[model samples]
Target: MYPFNCSQSTTTTCNASLYHATSLGRHDSTRQIATYYSVNETQLHPITGIHNRQDYLVTVPCSCGTVSGTTAYFHAVNYAVQQGDTFSDVSAEVYSGQVWVVGDEKQRFVAGNNVTMNLVCGCLDGKGTEEEEGEVIVTYTVEDGDTLAASLSRVVGLNELLTQNPGFIDVGWVLYVLKGSQVGCGDFEKGYFDAEGPVRYNIEEIEEATNNFDESKKIGEGGYAKVFFGILRGQEVAVKMMRSNKSKEFYAELKVLCKVHHINVVELLGYASGDDHVFLVYEYVRNGSLSDHLHDPLLRGYQPLSWSARTQIAVDAAKGIEYIHDHTKTRYVHRDIKSTNILLDDCLRAKVADFGLAKLVERSNDDELIATRLVGTPGYLPPESVKELQVTSKTDVFAFGVLLGELITGKRALVRDNKEPGRLKSLITTVSASSTHLRITLKNMDILCIKMVQPVSDLVRNLSGSSLEDQFRNWHASSLFSSYPI
Candidate 1:
């Protein structure tokens, strides 16, 4: 955990109160206190400079005797460590007895650098002894797209979590999370979204807006949330009314969507929560989900997307995933990257929706595999998800590869046709069952229905390969140059 300065020692006073933190100027030490979860520093590093000093504020709990308390520190010492000094070396030189240094060795203390040793108030974890909140079982249901780190971060700020649950966290494996105000919805509300006010809407206002949840007004349905088409304040809106019993997914998605904003992402306009009902209001896209346009033939008022249109849809959807993957302030993996999750606008623009299954990863550091229960749609699940329950951005990439096949072939990821006597075959299964000759498959199946161009054919060949990374890169690149004469 990163250290923060406490200007005054709690040795004199301890009272139950929220901790107050102040930013100490940055040091030449390669490490930073920004990752200290108590503070909201989502970006990897904005303090990478050799000549400038940055300020970082961190909050930590203070304990006084047997009661919870906090203290103010006005004269905290900030040490400017030279090249030869380590945290241990500095702690021994600066503080008197029983001072423990808490920084990584990889970060060398540079000359002319300043570092603050946060005075440890009696036992940070409530108890007077050194024992931290060891383990208190809190049943957090794994949301649709949650990775272990994101889930843990939700329960406890990232700093304490590293100390409590040090290694890989799995989905659906009930684990213990930190309890109390420090790691609850109250903390997230105060620290994360203090700037945005009144997220919660009135249930009565929503009911009147949606005509008392009229059947006709219902735009979409799912296990966790039912989407309604509503007009709020004279603009079209999609209101997601979550199952009152399952507030976990509601909070999970809201937490993520609140931080994320993009044209290609469904906007979370507002929300309402009460004892009996909870609702999320979003910007309503006139066209339905990609699934409705692509596969639901009975639906009216829409023409089948032309090859160019479909290609554009693919590009837009890819951009949404790219935003979630790498472009966002913090990288997120959309575990459920499938057609239904991709919604369409009136102008045929695609927006990625349903953040219920997304997980957060460090920007440019997504290769770390998170092991969890297999939870994505069957046909869209990657090989690693099924075989080892491991998840990464490539898992989304694999699912996107399936979505690409869905777009190109105009077929469901898994389906059964009476003409084919066998059971349901996934798109991958059909591709694999086809003969080694790519030309024969194209000639017979006429998948995509375009002239057999070299680039398109090569893309089809790439689908059969093992690397989802290569496949998505190839397809994303192809989507850029694709031209189909309709």
Candidate 2:
């Protein structure tokens, strides 16, 4: 048992006593505790009659013989004012009971002033417990020298990765090692050695096809390349072996040709680049060139193109040019447009062949114009092109006009005729002299609906002025017409 005391007011006194006893083997033992004390305090306030000094004690028994304990006496000034009470009023009320001594600092907390009260206490035992764990997940880590394609092949199963993420894999995969010992996959940097596409063929395969570019296999030759008929993978192909190093123009032409899949444009199968050689593989066109058929007099009698056929060829060529100008993302200008550059397939369909001189328009600036060294066939070149007047699409139009004139007259733009000095000059002179007669014939047919005869007589008179009659007489004497047996 423990003794306890209760006291209040400035001069107070209280006392308590505790007694405990336990009997064992018929022998009795007892213990007693008593306390008498007076607590001192100062005057609190002038208002309330309550005391600020108070004390209380409690007693309990313990297992060991009777134990006693005492608590320190303390003065607690506790006064709770009702709502709407001013701090001064609360102080006054507290002092009236002599429970507290009001000071200037206590007066600062006036009524209607926001104030917060905080309580602090101590506990003997306070603790907390924790919860259980969850399941664990497993993953693999990519080490150094790993690629994105390889990592994906391992993580998601190789078959699924190949089928589901083909596009990602084909974009040249990359792997990055993170700071936390993790790995990531993405596209590789451009121009890196690993960024190249899969090789379709090796140098050995191409060499065997061309017979090591033997002179015997060479079918045609150009300014910078030689074309050979080669068998690649059991298929006939025309392989052009470039004579010079790679240039931006060559790559640009290749990019354009790859995208141009029109029937009227030559098809590009594939290209190969090596340390010392560059090769372009294209589909072989069996028929030769338009120039061969047109210029070789021996072949003319065998195949004389009809006017309708000529018109169709011109229209097809125009459509091909229009496509190059309109359909592509970049406008292409064929700086060289001539008959020799046009090839005819087995069906006599024309396809524009050479693109080495083509140029791509880069920007939308109006002042932009493509300028180059003088490079074109003299006879087919336009007058403006000769003077270099900022060549444009109109220059190609002028060249086409010359080709049309050639198809009509069946004569080369520039021909060497010794009988008539300066052939183009003489041709122009002859045409000018007969222009009046030709115009009258056309006019009569248009207005009078009459087939004129004097126009023919004027043509005969114009021919009589030159040595053309003598040439015709000698042609009649030759036996070239005797085979007709007429």
Candidate 3:
């Protein structure tokens, strides 16, 4: 794993203190500390710039501080290199029901000396799984000499734990137990609605809104659904109608989308269901999409987007994605994030659309990389997603990086290579092949491309991208966009 400056870590509270980590593994020589886990840099200021794990003792962030309000970090640094994970000192009191990293499932952590516990905390009291009701779903990184059995035994039975986990759990590494090992509520039961917050619109109200699905009101079309502009109770709305009878398919997507609400995310005004179709209504965004302004020839010359406008749009979109990843009642991974999906308002502010399109993880762990058929734009798809057909929050971050490249350089994620007309070059490979101090010209805007390009290029290359929260915070605070100085 690469090391980065933990100046701006991803953790929301960050109430924990610093750990001076010395890497026992090799990392990219050029890796910046900003890429992975966040830590307070004040106490143990990390050595930044031009360093590698093989050559030097690079300090890493082992700050297992706070995982939201209810929990604290359980640093499991001291373990007795045993055959299997043993009970630890922290678990002496009582604890159970926290899932480990879903990506690296069933691996033994005996060989690891300094096990890095990077738990993406998802703790919202009322939002826990219906089956897991009062029991919270927060992950705890076990400290060096702690055993969780005592606490876990009190919380849940040994038989229940064995049945849910079903196999051996590695010590030092995180072994969590969420109440249930399941997917979305809808994935199992077809017609059930979590029905937490989103409104349900009657079929007649929807018909009146779109004039009975009139072709004249059509605004968009794709494999997923058909979009129509409508007036719902005097409020202008965009209704997305998907033709399918699988109410089970609609359950998870609708439930996840309903709970998400932020200024940057496109609001799900309500939903409707017909025998053969599903309708999702959203607040209408007048300015179309960032793709329309950046890539469409018809709009580009007519109303060229200002660099100032581009930066704000990027910031707005970043915040929207970050919200779903970290701050939501249940953290979600946006399966498809692309330029067209980012809608622009009349004021040019961005509202991330198609978030409801995100598929739920097969299991409870939010950050787990669930394997499935790969679905994303060609150039925007990260290497891991393409290779493994698995997706996580990182998938969206990778796509957002491509979007950033498009904003800075006015290029599509995939472009027809001028040298080889038959081959399409990706933004990641193209930008990564460039020298550090490059310059570009766009719409009489003599853009200084060198500084801005590094961050964009790093992201497009999928270099351990920072969480949307960290990236958004860094992007807004950056002064590298010389052309669009705030």
Candidate 4:
């Protein structure tokens, strides 16, 4: 179906729009109504919302025209579902993995027959005028465990997130979130302003905060960095300490960290350098990590995450990964994406952390496919990353699938090693059939992930952001593999 195109000379002027679309199912938070009427993918500027100078709500444009001497703002089309059409993947080729038509729309999609679709739109008139003093309102039908913070992820931060979306959001409640090209909020509002540049701290400040690198102040540690909990101007923050002279990694990490600013991704507040040591300060997430809550809650002194929480965590982490993969100027492959790297706040909201292993993908004949030395936690890496040593965006996708399995089964990616006592077994071998709740769905999945010690590559590549929520409704998590050889 082609769009109803009109010349600029004949096109009519329509004021600020208030388009409304309903999510018919409980699992999906967002859905797209097929608008064959749009001539192209046109980006629309902010219309109704009361936005500050910095952030602008990003949206797509729609056409409006007069009919029977009355102005009508609507677009529709008739479409016959094809053979392979399904509810979430209807017939939109460009909008794959985001087709969330349900209820009557679900029936129409399943019938493989002709069905009419349209965009519902209207405007709230104020004082006899089409203008209004409000943002574009999108009404969402809340699911079982949707909190206001969950909607705030990837959209905005602290003050902006709270102010724009006030009141508690619960199941079956309607929740709204603001979106824009520059619309965002900082991690915290107390010590710093929103969208403030990363601060360059004096090394003495970090030394005093950590009490001269005292081990007692340490909160977390990794292969490359040690994390310490400290307070910065009445606000709690996590300071990661590392060696600056190690490799290109420190500079690379700073470069990558400064460029990204999304709610799902962890926020870097400032940094310091002295005596060949570097300190990176970040907003301290209250909860520990996804790995802690999932594996053994009783021993870890935490409660097991509910099924809904697991699903939400997956969605939130996916949004973070998707931001780095798609939104950044030079796309990066987060070489490390595991349950441990996903930290949670007091609200149990997930944010992706640690970009030390992240590699900037410079596409070329040699760089794109070049092999690097093996680095990453076991059980999360794929065959291409392990054997080929090739680091690409697909590597993160593979690790994420394993992380999803961890969320489902509450089992570590790698089990005890059978080949060598006190060692580890293949990651693919351990986690593939770990959960009775989930089983393999695809034949290629078995061949690639389970049958061999091989793990997920492109199996979960299609899954991202809110799509993870939609995936659980339909397919089981695919198999996983190891970064190490069997």
Candidate 5:
């Protein structure tokens, strides 16, 4: 058993009048000061060698005119230490199902606060065994004051915890184990671990299936992680395994993806987590990304995508981006929207993927703006994003404009042939220049004359009265192409 104590320095002022109500006889107008227990560990337990459980005693001071009138209540002390975990991990275990007790008028006891109380050891043991692979496996028991990190440390190797659990063991997994342990001896049975259907591959099984992350099997690499093609349950799947255990962005991405239930968005098949790895499984799109079709010269000639097909692709991509911004409960700003990230299905439908840079904003608050590190591909990024280092849905709109320009002009965003100086420009510039020539072509083609001089005579008739005629006459006198019709 762990030794315990109470420190007077840690005491809080309480309502003396409340304690007097519980006592017999007369009531006192003076404030009551309650005495509570606190504990300090001097050494480890002799038998278990674990410096775990601590108990505290809380005494209510009351003037009952007798020694028996004064009573002390015993309560267990609870506290928490940070063990690097996702928010979900901490919330489910540490805060769930804990009851708060009312103390003096000025004070209250919370679950996270360190407390002292008396409780018997082994009061909650229900350890059993299961036959797995013809061998008996003993159930893991979490005694009082057992933390997930400590419990997993006692049973499995420490390296296994780091290697198998990407995030550190926090209250969330512990609460899950506690709740599951009360029900049965198996793992926590949630949607991801259902038994009605075929069993999905665990982290170990997925690693084995991918040939221990062979470089030859690598399909794609991104800022946060890598993609690999793998077979699971005899079905082809694309597995995006995260690169680091410390990425909060990866967890954010997973949270957003799991909540999104759109047909246009890529579906999440399954996920696996180990100490060093976090894997997201998705359905494989055989045709690959939109960037491959747009930029690859070898692919362009085989099947020339018509203008109508390109316009449809633009509309499909816009709908996906719009869905993230408007349809979701919280508005999502996909900071990174580029051709490469827009995946193409076999039927040529575009699905937006790679939400690692996405951010959720409040609906009611217009004043709220998020300022973080600048992230996105160059040339495709909007001017506001580049200058202000701010990202909003409007930023995505500007990027969409760039994508539309690419679709219309059939040219890359930055790449242009330098030899043909005035030959190529942006879609906006080309359209503006073409409009002038189109008007001239329409005028010259509209008036067909019997002789070449009659064309100039018709041009002079059209422009004889306007102010433009004076400028044309002045320009014609100095120009070498004066014979050519305007």
Candidate 6:
């Protein structure tokens, strides 16, 4: 993974030290600021990262020239207008937000100006040519009735096109399409523009598909969302309904899903957003999460996974994490890695899901640890995550190791109120005490493994002591654990 280096800034008063650290990994980087600025500002930059230049570069006259910070004053002002403020109203309070235009002499927005600025979409500018680098570019020719904006709308967001290519109007000109990077249209684009983003399903369509969100269709629920089985356009899908459309997790998941595409990662088909609720559409996996299969006795219709199937599930999940960390344009850390988030397909193949806590990191020095908020499920969290909020891909690896233990022992990570002394002891803490301890646990697992191969009653009647244990110990020493890095 690459390292991220943060740019430094100094204020005139006391030389305010902006502790700039290189991008540790995807888990540390944020999307609040546009890429036009530093990879991601961590200094005096706001929590959302986008702010006016005057606020930070007070002593400077031209914020554009102030290379100390890649301050985009217009972005905050843009957001103000997008939130329903008029030109006059926004300009009046622009200075308070420390916003200003670089070339404008008056240092204020001209009143009643429509063409001067795109009030509709303040921060989401342009067709994102750089953003669409890996996308397959296709061509579209303007029809007789189509305007330039209309022509481009068929391929990309009109506002984004206007931002990317200003004054693009030709009746018959050819336009390029960046396969799947279009923005959504709704109240979000009330009077501004229109285009397709990832699939957008109407609320009614979602309701109808899920039988009006019938309880029977409800598959799973989480801290911030719920998953329901649905059929849209004749294709089965899993619709994840969020508490609201504006939460940080919704945007985080959307941003991560927009960039990732791999068989091992759950495919995001499209989404629906509104003031009250947001729904994410994903390719449905018929079998439930790996946790349910491994630990839920009430889970119906499915037999226990074979030993080979368990190993394959781990391998598939590892590939998904590998793609996120190494193959993305930048490194990504799946902060919440657990059996619950690993779903099994009809063929019992595993695919990683739930990227609400995923982080985008840029490679700079090495895969340095960066500070972030501590957020993840209980037993799966690593020591650094719980102690200091310092995390790297190694954090996910630690969680994966715990998951592997669950698969091997056929036990949950945390066993509550068990006969065991430590009621909530994590599987890793228990079995990973030492190599000898792990070997002993594997030896007991050998008996469980044999039950799958031979009837337990017959094995008890016919088996000799230490024979099966010896065979498994030999295999475990040479074949099983040897093949795994853990």
Most accurate candidate by lDDT: 4
**Model 1 clash pairs?**
7-73, 8-73, 15-69, 144-357, 145-357, 145-358, 201-271
Per-prediction TM-score = 0.50, 0.45, 0.52, 0.54, 0.46, 0.53
Model 3, stretches more than 4 Å misplaced?
Answer: 1-196, 245-249, 297-302, 360-366, 437-486
The TM-score that candidate 1 achieves is 0.50
Which ranges of candidate 1 are over 4 A from the true structure?
Answer: 1-198, 363-366, 369-371, 417-422, 432-486
- Ordered by TM-score, highest first, the candidates read 4, 6, 3, 1, 5, 2
Model 5 residue 36 distance off true place after TM-score fit, in angstroms = 66
What lDDT score belongs to each candidate, Candidate 1 first?
A: 0.52, 0.41, 0.51, 0.54, 0.44, 0.52
**What lDDT score is found at residue 155 in candidate 6?**
49
Model 5 segments more than 4 A misplaced: 1-201, 297-302, 364-368, 417-486
Q: CA shift at 387, candidate 3, in angstroms? A: 1.2
Candidate 2: TM-score?
A: 0.45
What candidate 4 gets wrong by more than 4 Å, as runs, is: 1-195, 363-369, 417-423, 433-486
Cα lDDT tens digits for candidate 4, 1-486: 111223324322122222222223313212122123222112112222212221112232223444334343333345566687664443233221122232477666655586654432322222112332222322222334334444355333212433355444444332233322121223321111112347898988887877777889888988878999887766678999888774466677787877665567887778888887888888788899888897776687888886567778876787788767654445778889998999997779899999887888863443354655898887888777778788767677768777766665566777676567798765444655554334444333432133222222234343334544544533334323223211
Candidate scoring better on lDDT of 4 and 5: 4
lDDT of 5: 0.44
Scanning candidate 4 in windows of ten residues, the lowest lDDT window is: 37-46
276-390, model 2: which lDDT tens digit per residue? 7677777676665566545653554437554455545555555566556544435666767676676677657666776776776642444235476665666656555667645
**lDDT assessment of candidate 3:** 0.51
